[model samples]
Target: MNLTPADTEVTGKPASRAKRPAKSAPGAATSAANAAPTTTPPVTSSPLATPTLTAGVASVTHLTEKLAEYMSPSDLKKVKEAYRFSDEMHLGQVRKSGEPYISHPIAVAEICSDWKLDAQAIMAALLHDVMEDQDVKKDELIERFGAPVAHLVDGLSKLEKIEFQSQIEAQAENFRKMLLAMASDVRVILIKLADRLHNMRTLDVMAPAKKRRIASETMEVYVPIAHRLGLNNIYRELQDLSFAHLYPLRYHVLAKAVKAARGNRREVVKKILEAVKNTLAMAEIDAEVYGREKTLYGIYKKMRSKHLTFSQVLDVYGFRVVVDSFPNCYVALGTLHSLYKPMPGKFKDYIAIRKLNGYQSLHTTLIGPYGTPVEFQIRTQEMHRTAESGVAAHWLYKTGDTNMSDLQQRTHSWLQSLLDIQQQTGDSAEFLEHVKVDLYPDSVYVFTPKSKIISLPRGATPIDFAYAIHTGIGDHTVSVTINGEAAQLRSELRNGDIVEIVTDPASRPSPSWLSFVRTGKARSAIRHHLRTINLPESIVLGRQLLTQALAAAHLEPDLPETLIERLLNESSAKSLDELYADIGIGKRMAALVARHIYGLMGGESAAMPVDHANAAELDPVTICGSEGVSVQLAQCCLPIPGDQIIGQLRRDQGLLVHTLDCTVAKRQKQKEPDRWIPVKWGSDINRRFDSRIKLLINNEKGILARVAAEIGESDANIVFVGMDEDAEHVLHQLRFTIQVKDRVHLAGLLRNVRRVAGVNRVLRERS
Candidate 1:
């Protein structure tokens, strides 16, 4: 992983040519021919002398020594210059621990150097805190270092100058800024992660509340990000540190327990190790085996989630076998299995199907030494490197190997997705929400019809799958099939299922998809599409609602231009469409706005107060069941045509139509009577409506199929079906949400279902 001279070609002047001024004898004539040039500053202290420390903070001399191993002389010179400048900028600043603030940046840069990051990244790391803490400007850094370094420094800086409504909002906006920068250049997040790791390491000096807050934030955001980027070494350390700070007692208790377990199991571990080594030696396989210990957080999480005791967590101690080649990984796995009994359904081959983060290993569990389960992971040396370093291996190895390139590509793809989500999302809080949704580490690998592997979050539906394939496909997805059989779009996909999506140009996303989708891409795409179509539809609906309200006062539907202008001005609307949209979306009451418009027109009845008793005499608003988002059918009662329905004007949700007899609607009416509007079904209704029904049937073979067939024969499409068995009565209670044309269509479907053989009773379900 060390860099050669060719890899150290940084953008700057040659080291020898760019030299610092040397001290001369007092009043001596300067001669250009005799002048001495050097890249490093003249040493005031002897190299063998005791090191100088400020508040227990070491000097940058150590950093330069480490850089000398892989960095070119010129790049090394630039890094020392950066360190000196940063040290000067943070002169009197001190940390909470009373250490010189320069120590923090030095520690962060050392972490980056450990990763073999280029000289430019090292310089950026040293200066990352200056812009945020010292108010240093980016242009100054550009003049001092270069544009690339300056950009990285700027990316690390927070938006502290701007005031936000809340601290969470401020944090979210800052993260949003940093993420967008990371999408452009991956080094931003890499440096930022190093910075966060150092802070977490030294977080004990902070107040209790601040410690918990920072620890929780690190666990929620940075920890997942580290895991996503495949930084296993850093990821594990961060998890342990966060666990230690967030739950000090639990972390210490688990740590102690693990320590004791190690002593008690030492003999068993030794026996298994010898057996595996002897078996592999006989098989003539070359491998390096090492024991792996689980992190404290991992143990605590396992105990809490799976309800296991410390001893029940058998895989806490495991082994990793690093081989010389990919084929040897499986050879070692087989060799080890020969020495012990392999556990069924406890093996996973990640090499054939790599994780989304580009992690590859062959994992298995074996019964070792007195029936104890031991976990083993087999991988090649290169795979091991990639697993530990992840995308950072691209720079560390600099070999352009297939594995390294694939890891880089996968990371870039994920970062690019964040940018796409940012473009679709406008609010910082909402963008952060979407990012959190995407950050979940657990993923399931499924397949496209063409055998292409597509990885999605666990519990992700076909909607998420469609969007993962393409935004256009997701927008136009009409149906899908799982494993060559028709399946609901909301079905939870399983591993290895072949998902085939059917799209139509006329098909569009439904708002209900937001309830089941697990990916942010699908959610954002649906919202963007809905917003695009909502405005125009809302304007039209608002006009109809206002016109109906105006008719109650004996006014014309089309008002004079002067009166319209006055109404727009009085309503604080920039345009007539804005005014109507507000009314359509229920932001303003149509009746009050109509009365206000009447007064603008000098109508005598405009002075009359609104009469609630006469509300029934007004013209009714007509809904055709296809009024887009501006008009919606309430899901509580699932109102359809021929059902006596009333409209409830909900702010920002537009008009919700519900059955007049719905108990939920009655409760709402008692609280907010003025929000209720008289509505009627239009003659041109053409779409199907969902109605729920409950059925009790005799428990017998093929009874469910018989009832479903009866509903299908009546031309009703079943959207969802749920069943519960009554063992005491030997009957089954089945609930179905089916789509039909109207109340009449639903009645016919119910009648068919009731006539099916073995049917005990059928009734419409209302809330």
Candidate 2:
């Protein structure tokens, strides 16, 4: 398997660009230049300095020097110790590029140093691969570098053996574990990110399929995470590199497009930068101004998503202005607008309203020289540092060597938030799903009644906002008032909208909210509440299921606890507690549990019901049996009490009950006869069942309203309704999930459905 990096992209042309009047700011061309760092320490030539260091014996002296700019001697010593340990452990191993494996760790540490990470993070980076690739141990690491650094390194290690059913599942699980570990300590994530970046840089050595898989995962998982953490520099580079590997043709095309745009925008960029530089100088603002080009991935993403040609994708160029102070950032913004025509409605002040990751900047798009559109971001030196280094910048920017309580609080809040999400969500797939959604870069900023601004992911409705504000507000949300107007509680929020949530004591989370809510926290909280509320009922159902299963096996319901415990021990369960917990969580099949419990209680081949009166009735109305298949018709397909039916013995799956006339049954019988079983509807069955009906109504605005009314009149719940269309008809598939005592009740409901206006076909689905 291979792992690569991913990139990011800008979405749209400036909305206000369409309303701009052409204007050109006259100025000399600015030099094609890169900005210099505000403070630079002297560099020392390395022994292996062919430019970069050599393998195995390469000194981390440069990394140490860089660290010294950000850390103390004690911390520096700790980092050196870690580097030395990694070097010894990787003494003989080598990378595909023929560099010693120790060089890889040194390189990873160097990347982290570029982020200006704290001593612990850098130390962890230097030792990240030791446990994974060598015989070195975590205990050894702890002894050398202390518990925290060792713990961070251990957290960053990939599982040694992944016994997943498929490669995708294995990779996904590995990513899940990585994210979970990262949630506990942000440093683990930083080290992992550095590791991934280095791996991506070496991905060309891997095979093509592996390259694509790794690159896709990087795009889908890691890059979004980096973006969420405000590590946009890494985020963007990862995206670009991954795209280059995963879609080289597209990457080159987009790169050329951006390069060509840069060449064409040369005069515009030069004039814009000169005008801004001169304006800032006149305003006596000490600032650094640099031009920024959109990454190739950004251009490709815009072209692919918007179905636009390369030239049609605007906003491909921008500039970054870094000032010495927060006040000077606004001054620079003012200077920029004065020098160029400001595009109306194309300004955002992120400094006043910071992002979830604490990113702060003033963003604007202007009609620059030659009427070309350009985006500009203005920020202070500190904001620039944070923008590049993200959480790592906190270590360097603190004054007087003060404690990191405030920084720790903010970082810990973000970390603990992930753990909270994990606790509420049991399914790894669902947890990852929520994390992906939460990591989307598009954001919507809203305000509370007290005027405190909060940002949430775009498309986030008020329910998400409620949870973001406080869990109590989310759990008890009854209604909401958006900007003084009563609004539906699920209303989508907009930028700068003031929202007030209304709660009721009796209000509780609904499963339906999962369909509309967007944030991970809100989704997890709602699901957790629902899970808790349903647990007692589920446990009761489980008990009934267990008791009925025991009766089927000719065993007593209340067998001795000692016998059950002995049976569980014989099974794989370490103790009864594990068995019961599994049963409670639906992980252990109730039927299986009952069978094991009954077998331990003297069940025999001869069947008998200990309590004949309490034996569950084999109701013909609910339980359909065909050819010993014991096919209970799926309520979804609804083979009625008298309906002819067939059973599909699904592979590693439950028998699927279907009517004899069901097309699905016919297809399955044709393909796999040995898997098929006969089924019949039980005579005494009395449970309510659901079957779908279709209506071909003329496509009209209110056709859905009439059909819904008819279903309501029939006393049926509209469990689901889906609409498909053709030129000839608006095909509506309506699933009336209703209670039916028997075949007669179903027939009557079908007849009633047939009478509804525009109802075309009310036939039951074939088994």
Using TM-score as the measure, which candidate wins?
Answer: 1
Report residue 715 deviation for candidate 2 (angstroms).
9.6
Each candidate: RMSD? 10.5, 13.4
Local lDDT at 226 for model 2:
78
In model 2, where do residues sit more than 4 Å from their true spots?
1-59, 68-74, 161-177, 396-410, 505-507, 536-767
User: Ten-residue segment with the worst summed lDDT in candidate 1?
Assistant: 1-10
Estimated TM-score for each candidate: 0.76, 0.70
lDDT of 1 by residue, 483-522 (tens): 9999999999999999999999999888668779999888
lDDT of 2 by residue, 506-607 (tens): 988765576689899998898677555655443443354455556656666776778866776665566554444445444456556665565566664234
